[model samples]
Target: MTCLICGTPYQSTPTWSKLFLNQLDSSTCTRCFEKFEVSESTIDFTDFLGTPYEGAVDSVFCLYTYNEPMKEFLHQYKFLQDVALAKVFAGNLQQAFQTREGIIVPIPMHPEKLELRTFAQVDELLNAAQVSYQQLLVKTKSETQGKKTKMERLETSNLFEAMSNIEATNYILFDDIYTTGATIHHAAKILKDAGAKRVDAITLIKG
Candidate 1:
């Protein structure tokens, strides 16, 4: 009935699944949504080959690229604290995780940052997708990764600690973005060290 991004009312043609499954509807308008680009497969992690982070993550699946549209979207969703934007990708995200066979675990925000951001963006994405996930790890450090160089990020001390007992099963690490691979690697390494059988990752974007 209405596009979430542009605010101009638009008609969403009915589909079979929309009629039967009570699924989430498109929150983004065709014009705005088309501006966003879906990326290809996993990002380049060849730099980690000989590093301690090698094999820390089995694979990474990214849904979108950090294109201009995505850049704008993230600004509104995270920095501007528009929680509703999380629903824009709900249906797509649900479909992505439908075939994965691991326990979903979203990367957590630090307490202070969570207070500032008002909501956990990563968790909100999963919730908007109606995907169940466990909060197994807690962020112990709050250093901003945006300013750090690739090597600086890789060499930084671990930022997470397990908040609960991690079962020795495969776990899917979910995050909002994959930048230098530091956050995912640190989180995955923590899970691996805590005895998770396998750790793979999925992100909303590949930066």
Candidate 2:
């Protein structure tokens, strides 16, 4: 098989998990996959501390740290519209979610941005991983959060509105990346306010 990220041909090795557990293997080869650094840094919630949104999110689980290879991967998959690249991290994402319990909810993109991007990048990740998820929130603000400063981002309000009545159940929010975490917090707050018992997040890259 050809490594999805580096385009180098490599062999896929079968293991106990693949043979018995039916675990899906990542599309990228071992060498290219190793370029994504595993993230161990804990996410801080001080930005929402002391606010109504304090404790909105229970915890955040990040798989990879932002790096050069991941940067290039995001550029090609998200901006260049390479939908197939979503499968690159399928094994990693699936394994992470298996140990967690919740109603998987993917963060929704703004309608305008989705139109421009031609796809919901976050949802595509879940689809590629074969993870079941619900669309529970709608992005309200149309402006991109990337251009905003940290304070400005935290100050941005009503970023998401609940799509339906949220049950008093645990929810796992999925996203493509976690930066200042404003986006994830906003979505979590809305769900919590709408009656979700607990909210946690899983992000592809910790930027």
* TM-scores, all models, native as reference: 0.95, 0.96
TM-score of 2: 0.96
Candidate number with greatest lDDT = 2
Q: What TM-score does structure 1 among the candidates reach? A: 0.95
* True-structure RMSD, every candidate: 1.4, 1.1
Candidate 2, residues 47-117, lDDT tens digits: the string is 77876678989999999999998999999999999999999888879898999999999989889999999
In model 2, the runs with Cα more than 4 Å from the true position are none
Residue 47 of model 2 has an lDDT of 77
In Å, residue 3's CA in model 1 sits off its true spot by 0.9
lDDT of 1: 0.89
lDDT of each: 0.89, 0.90
Model 1, range 143-181, lDDT digits (tens) per residue? 898888888888888999999998889999999999888
Using TM-score, give the best candidate's number: 2
